[model samples]
Target: MKRYYQQEEDIGLFQRMQQDDPLAFEEIYNRYFLKLSNTAFKRLQDREMTEEIVQELFVNLWLKRHRLPELKQPESYLQTLLRNSVIDWFRARARQDGFAAEMLAQPDRQIVNATEQHILYADLQQAYESTIGQLPDKCRQVYALHQQGRSVADIADQLQIAPKTVESHLLKAHQTLRHVLKDYSAVAVALFNFVF
Candidate 1:
């Protein structure tokens, strides 16, 4: 009985949100923020990152509110978004740690010889730099900033470029890197896909 009432209430909130009601958006955020935060924190284990992820989730919800009316269950939709965001965070962390570590950190590497891994790592490093060198000036700068953990918005502000422009630069960098890196190492290319 209570669940039915809650569903009805959620539907009402979504309807209002679809109509650009800030109060409805706030109500949804207030209702789910704690629940979503708890779930994200359990998966992330870092309070700051959990908070950032949940906050981004709400920001995105508000940004995409017009589509809320199409959702059958806002809670389920939010949960899925949170899950994907957590996975993306993990992938980004892995990328920042270095491609050699990403590729060779697995248990399977233990079965392979260290000398081979060292050669592979050196080759990958060379190819990575060479590929990066191929990027245009501004695109390279944006990619470098991103590699340094700067957010797209931050990079845009720092570079005095639009966010979409920053994203375009990033996408170009990733495509160029992925394409060139694939010829050198498929594993590197696979890990490289996380940039998106």
Candidate 2:
């Protein structure tokens, strides 16, 4: 039966993956990556996010392969993982927005004096630099130009890459920054909205 064959195939792949077989793991990735990406993109509508979620899911699958859960349908298992990842991603984004909103709504007792302004600027600068430093070389360059008010097409032209490549770098940089700069949620939200 079809179900029997699927079970046999998945079981073999799962067992092989557990034993650290790269071919088996690659087979699983090829089987599920696009399908999972489609499912995620259908819900998220953001190509970069969809790709990131699928990539992370596969990476996690490999890293935790030896302890992979027992399942009747491996495809279903992957779907569940992707779905959960999407939920978590949205939740974190919402939290970031909420933090920004809260910070904006809070009442300050007095106008910030020069010293306070200087200290605040220093903190923001430190966090911003640290976040930017973590980006890949191409991504960091794209981000720098983008920060200076360059359009995506402009960045691509300057960097001699496609516009889509520019967008991908920016998206990757944004995701990385937003993740590490969690405590500076207001800054993250502002930059996140500015980037894309």
Q: Pick the candidate with the highest lDDT.
A: 1
Give the 10-residue window scoring lowest on summed lDDT in candidate 1. Answer: 187-196
Candidate 2 achieves a global lDDT of: 0.73
Candidate 2 stretches with Cα past 4 Å from truth are 1-8, 99-196
Worst 10 residues of 2 by lDDT: 187-196
Q: Give me the runs in candidate 1 sitting further than 4 Å from their true place.
A: 1-8, 100-196
TM-score of each: 0.48, 0.48
lDDT of 2 by residue, 64-182 (tens): 98788775567667766776787677667866778446545654522343356466656766776887887789999999887665668888998899999999998899788767666
